[model samples]
Target: MSPRFQCKQRGAIGLMAVGVLAVVLAFTLLVVDTGRLYLEKRKLQGVADTAALEAVSRNGTCLAGLSAATYAGQSVARNHFVVGNGNTLVTQCGAVTTAASGQRTFSANPALSSAIQVVASKTVTTSVAGGIWSLFSGNSVSLNTVLTATAVAAKPTPTLAQLSIKSTLASVDTANASLLNGLFSGFLGGNVSLTVAGWNGLLNTNISLLSYLDQLAINLGVSAGNYTQLLSTNVTASQLVQAAITVLTANGATADVLTALGNLKVAAISQAPLTLGKILQLQTGTTAAALNANLQVFQLIQGVVQLSSNQSAASATLPVSVLGLANITTQIKVIEPPQLSAIGDPALAVANPLGPNAIYVRTAQVRTQVTVSLPVLNSLSGLTTAVNNLVGPLTPVLSGLLSLNLVTTINSTLCLLGAGCQQLDLLVLPGNLPLNIVLDAGGASSYVTAYSCPTGSAGTKSVTAHTTTSLASLNVGNITHAFSSTQPMSVAPMPLVDLGIQTCHKILGIGSCDPRVPFGAGGIAIQVQSNIAGSNSIQDLVFSSTTPFATPPNVGLASTYQAAAPATNLVSGLSTALNGVSITAYQPSGGNPLGALAPTVVALLGSVSAIVTPVVDNLLAPLLNPILNNLLNMLGISLANVNVGANLTCGQTGEAYLVI
Candidate 1:
């Protein structure tokens, strides 16, 4: 052969080899792309699952975990290729408006009582593969996919838990619905009970109504001395009665009587009363007439304290038999709030201006709460109906997935969805198609709240309710207590907000100010808070100012949580565990899911008075009731079981007694 002929033969062989290599390269690229698409789909499903769970959790809502997950998924999808979609082609990412980071959304119908619905979609394009594929196939290759998942999750119920209220309280106290069973049936103790009624279904920020009560307790410690002094000097029990009677008999014209009554130094009195007890300090100057009048005054005080002055005063006519007390005037000012506002400057007052010495006492309070257990009364009752109803709507779609062996994958994806997916993808080339996702969920629960008043020292019957509010920004876990201001803090109040995403709470620390908050009402005084640090609790906040000194909160958490301390003197340190309520949760047989949880929480509390509050009958009974019985016995006052039908007198005006 000639040289030219040999050269031509070599060229032909080279062309054939190049063509063969091209085919191999194409096949390899297809396999690699297929594997990548599979991996992307799995990863997208995971991101979607995580997003849904975060959305379902209460903390995630606050921390915006779902949104974060969506953002993360979008960022990841940017690395995938966009393939031209076809009937047989699979998607890597779902049909998304844009492949931007975090802008997509997945949501469940809150209206559904049971199931969690999720819809996740994103658009991804292979930056390299599409151009190369276009060069060879004369077509652009991109990936587009839509993914959705749904879950019928069990609601989180706070029932079924064995609760223990380690308190000295006599009965269950349902102060706020988030903390009690109200029936007392769930409670276990020597003789603990509960009274659930009239719940304020509003709990925002750290201060539920019950939490507000404890906060007030701290404030009380600050102003207790001044109020005690005010009690002693303002007017003696007898003096007040005499002044009122004098004004009454004179047809409400005796200004001098009014002035004298108002001017009487509460500092001079040693005892006062609710029904039978005298909350005053009688001296040698205390006369027989004064004592007699004091008894009447005590009766009036009881009526004034117990009844909610929040409403119009009742005009009941008690038959005037044995110096009856009637038509007592009452007034009240409350700092009750549902949620603390953060729109204004952080330095404005959130509570009424309080004096360092002139503390406000809980005159009378009736708190109640309800805790609906998990898997409560009828958790599964409507299940059959709901499932049957879904059959018609889901049949066609489910049949398709099953026929294509999609059940294992699609159904699994559905189960994986916790609440709602924020991001999900199948990694298919860019395509335009509508995906339908439908979900329905249902659940049941019971919730209740209950409360009692602060009992006072020396047998006083007071059910006092006092509360105040301040402004602060709370993150996922922590909370800050600033002065009476409405400004946003430089930092998040809770750790969850600061921690980025996906975290649980260890403690719901209630706060009115920072821990190092200055005591007293000098500059929105910060009382040393409990459930966090040191203790300096006193026996009772209601005490005589001149008796001695060592302010608490000079207040303490002694008013909120408690445990029996017979072995240790609780009054000595800030460790007086004497609060009255506890909570527990129950789960339906299936699982624990918060949204489905109705009365998920069961709170245990004590309302029966013994010896803590001090408004006598107004704000406290535990302390006031005992004192009343003891004092009346000492003073020769007695109960009359005169069951004269409608015109009956059970006991003394302010005294509590069994009318047999």
Candidate 2:
């Protein structure tokens, strides 16, 4: 080749060689640099994970939050490559700390951010082909080459979330529901909860169950706010109901107990859980539970109340007058102490003394000793003075729940207010009262009149009570025979069993017109014959007196009640009411009153309205207003709707009230 042309060709060859060298160098560097970067990243990431897990395990609550951030930083920086180059580069990194949130969001701190990072420097060197070729042109053996490389290693935003935040919320919702169901079942005496298994142990591993229970009672007022939110959890209606029941039971609320129960039943009936098995299980369980669990599905009660519409029952716009507010379902201890605001009418013992009741002075400074042998109470009553408080609506249907054995265990004295009495049927024979009483005075067991029944007229009997008493010996004999001449048994089934009117024979539970006892929308005409001169005793009874079942032709409403009134002895007034179907008298058997019904006084009271006050004339006492009483009784209404001074005082001494 020519010298000049040869030189140009050689230059081209060398240029091509240099380009190839550059290409190979770039490929090699790419592998080494990327690999180094990856390794460094892994190291930093592992550090973050370690520290974060430590903090989490420790539950750094004060900074359960702040520790998360610290952990992330610590993890990201734990490993590093200080490139011999004074320059240090960290691109991205991240770390996790907390387990979960109220929303079930579990992740390390800055969940999506890089927690650590590091970078390396760069350098380049010439290739063998370039150095050799340059040796021939100049005295130089090789040529210098420069290359730059930069490495960026960092944890990137998480493509995968450790935990979904929404999941946390879902979990909380579930847990809360379980807590609720568990509490409710426990309160109502149901089987121990499967969820709150150990909770049934009746002992808080952390504290005494009683202490917890007491604390719950105290904090209930405050915790109500926390619990109220639980009610609004985004769950099905049935689930919500279950939670509500649990919370209320755990809290031991008095007023809201029934209300919560009723609500649960209602939710069960309406929007049941979507889970079919759960729904069926709940239904069956509730059915079984209600047999023993009387926490009262207040929700169902509300439903029943809701059943009332703008309609009339026999022309009377129905006012939902539940007999009592407090019921027997709750234990008596759960009955909050009475406040004066609870007092109302019917303060006397008569006219259904158990209801429309009033509190009278029992033997204060009383000894707790029951018999000389066994005492009913543990400690003596230091009742030198009492702070009278009236309260109650807890009636038999809900309150006085009998034990499975049909036995009632009571260590405390029963105290009720006038409002309580208004709900009780006192005039009923034997009364709606679930107790027996015995009065004592005048050196003998006496039946002193505490007060006459509001709805009933007072009847007199010739009672001869002895006044002489002995200290060593208690004169506890029949005191009725002292007043007039021959005392006869006073309380019979008529005014005692139920406050109503009936035919003389019907009240006596025999020889009545209807061959069978009748109930529901029926009437009776009771009678009394003052056969006191020779007759000895008279009695009456009150029963369901249900009407006889019959075919369509015989289907009719019958006042399913039977009552009677009879008199003898020094009885005063005698008359019939219910258009002359029933009778009333003052005395039992024996003596007779000296005069007719009191006229002047009767004129003032205006026709005596189902009741006749005797003119000092004891005979007329029995025969007062019979018709008006039956009419009132027929209505199945009480004097509560109207305003009146109703006072019913029940006094029981030894042998005061005897049930045969």
lDDT of 2 by residue, 1-660 (tens): 789999999999999999999998876876665565555445534443444443333322212244433543344346442234432332222222323463322222222221222222323244555555577778576343432222212221111100000000111123333433432332222321233222222111111211222233233332211222222223333443344445555656444343534434443433312211110111110111011111112222211211210010111111111111122111100001101001112122223333333211100010000011012111113210110000111123223333322221121211222211111111221222211111111110111123221123443211111111100101111122211223542322122112121221223344333222221111111232221221112221212112242100100111111111212321121222112212222221122111111222223222222332221122222122221122111111111111101111222223111010
TM-score between candidate 2 and the true structure: 0.21
- Candidate 1 off by > 4 Å: 1-40, 46-73, 81-660
Q: What is the number of residue pairs that collide in model 2? A: 124
Write the residue-wise lDDT of candidate 1 on 103-138 in tens digits.
533222221211122334444445346557665897
TM-score of 1: 0.19
* TM-score winner: 2
Relative to the true structure, candidate 1 has a C-alpha RMSD (angstroms) of 43.1
lDDT of 1 at 221: 37
| Least well predicted 10-residue stretch by lDDT in candidate 2 | 159-168
Error of 2 at 112 (Å): 17
Full-model lDDT for every candidate: 0.23, 0.23
